[model samples]
Target: MFAPTFNLNLTLRRAVLAALLAAGSSVAMADPLHYHVEIDTSQFSGAGFLDFAFLAGNSPAPGATATLSQFSGAFGALDSKEGNVSGSAPGTLVFGNGGGYNDWFQNVSLGGRFAFDIVFGGDFLGTNGNVGTTFSLGLLDQSASAYLGNPNGNLLQFDLMPLNGALPASIAASTYASIASISAVPEASEWMMLTGGLALIGFALRRRRVAALTA
Candidate 1:
């Protein structure tokens, strides 16, 4: 009777460990997402200041908001916008310039309408180049002014999402269109750690069982 109970307990423990391993692995994976973040800043113009900017690297908590980071130091990704959609103006947009990053309304305004495309990439070179599966996008307000100014101040934010879901949109009063996105997955190192732990546990259990049999 004692031997039977001991065997049953060992079996139960092994089953529990396997279940936990499976659960942990599943929770850590969620394929990275791709996105198309389109915005309409036509109603306004940021002539002297950047109307928007974004932090690139993936973060620990990637929900529904653009994570904030400095312009110079970071890695994994780099947030950037394409050319001016304002009808006529070449090479007007500045990226990580004058020291790091910059942009303006003139770069995105088109006659009376403004539109631009930006890949909300983060600079992943600092102390944290860690990557995840989701993206954080941020829109600029003004150079302490709006409706039309040199620079934008306030930051409108969004989390974005899974690759196949719906694209997120933005703009305080204007319009926006999106197409879900992300870039995060569990590291190989984490898997190695898990494997090591399981091996040790199993070895210890086996030794205990042998000692019991000998006694």
Candidate 2:
């Protein structure tokens, strides 16, 4: 009788462990966030690179950022004056960060028809003055095929601030006077965790059944 009771206790403990894993996975998966934004640099033309960083509330120093190797994601496309930020339309590519030189694009394309997406670990916003809340996009003069993420050559740029605490739906999205951050979505990490947790649970259940039958 005690043998049966012992087995049952072990099974119950395994079930609890599986539940904890699911909870832990959910927490681990929730930090990554996505923001959709848009801009048009067609106003000017030349070359430049993205020159911005996550910053503290009002400080110039670099703020906290994602620990993952994939620190950031920039997806966009646009038409420009001297040249263009190339992409296949309806805009779904790892957008480059270049365009005009003297800031003509900034003047004209501040609030216009443009689109892009920002992705990073949301937890980074919790500290370092909520640095992750700050976001930036720019077109800096580059002599050749304009690439993404080489900041400093800012021709045109866009930014949003004080958003680290939380990302509200629609409200905070459009608070910026310039580009509009439209929507949000979950990518991969969350799904991956849920799948893994479910697999563990299934494995545990199978083992418990096999043990009971053999006993």
Q: lDDT of each prediction vs. the true structure? A: 0.34, 0.37
Q: lDDT for model 2, please.
A: 0.37
lDDT of 1 by residue, 109-182 (tens): 12232223333322221112223222223333334244332123232333333223232222112123222122
TM-score per candidate, chains pooled: 0.25, 0.34
Per-residue error (Å), model 2, residue 196:
4.3
For every model in order, what is the number of clashing pairs?
42, 15
RMSD of 1: 15.3
Of candidate 2, the 10-residue stretch with the lowest lDDT total is: 102-111
Candidate 1 lDDT trough over 10 residues, lowest sum:
69-78
